[model samples]
Target: MANPEQRPIGDVSVPLNTGDVRGFKKEMGRLLEDPLGGAERLDQFLGLNIYTWVELPSILGILFTMEERDMIRHSGMRVWDRDSQGPDQGDQKWPMQDPGWNNQNERHRQNMSDLQWMIIRGIREAVPKGQNLGKAVSEHQGKDEALEDWLE
Candidate 1:
């Protein structure tokens, strides 16, 4: 009979981008100073850094994969347009024309909500039953080394 000790821990795979993620954890040490101030700092940090990572191409269904492919797939332009002029479809040069500002703002709000829901769903899916997703740094993690349940 096979020993339970040799069994695999989980079906979920470690995210490919975790190395990039672990780099951001350095700010955590500073968060211990004053939580409110830390939160503000974290907000700034995430504003500058986190979105680009979280909003990966795959996450947004941009490119299908990192593997080489010549053609690209897209559902046409996302911005609303009248005739040929798209909302926020102005060149960045000095002669900037009025982009459909109303439509742009509406799209922005819709996108914000979509992003929030997507993140929440991703979090829910990552953590299966009986798994603690997060805990305090001082929590009593045990010494089980095989599957590392003790680290929880």
Candidate 2:
């Protein structure tokens, strides 16, 4: 994998665009809205490319809201530290760690660790099987990389 800092979040072996933050966020929302529907398109977008590098800071930006930015920062730190003992250890990684916030013409990614964790915690608490989806998404979508990705 590319150096963590230089790793373009867009190349995580998943389909995405390495571009600006805003459009990438919007596209991510759309993809998450219907991953299956977006899967084909995303796959095509990525083409034959493999081994995508993540952009930690940008990932946090798109995934988090202003109110939760600090929390995301903390989560990112935990990710970098390889501490499975992260604050919200059991929460999902994708949409937080390896978020697919990309567009066709973008060249970057963001980490929304805090907001995603909150959503994961909230959803799980609110619904009996909600937690399952979070884990499932991360695993199926290939966001489950080593914690070291965040550290570099």
Separate clash counts for every candidate = 0, 17
Write one digit per residue (lDDT tens) for candidate 1, span 11-52: 222343544334544543322233334334434433422232
lDDT for residue 34 in candidate 1, whole number 0-100: 36
Q: What's the TM-score of every candidate structure?
A: 0.24, 0.24
What lDDT is reached at residue 111 by model 2?
30
- Output the worst ten-in-a-row residue range by lDDT, candidate 2: 121-130
Q: So what's the TM-score on candidate 2?
A: 0.24
Q: Model 2, 82: alpha-carbon shift in Å?
A: 4.0
TM accuracy, model 1: 0.24
Runs off by more than 4 Å, candidate 1: 1-22, 25-103, 132-152
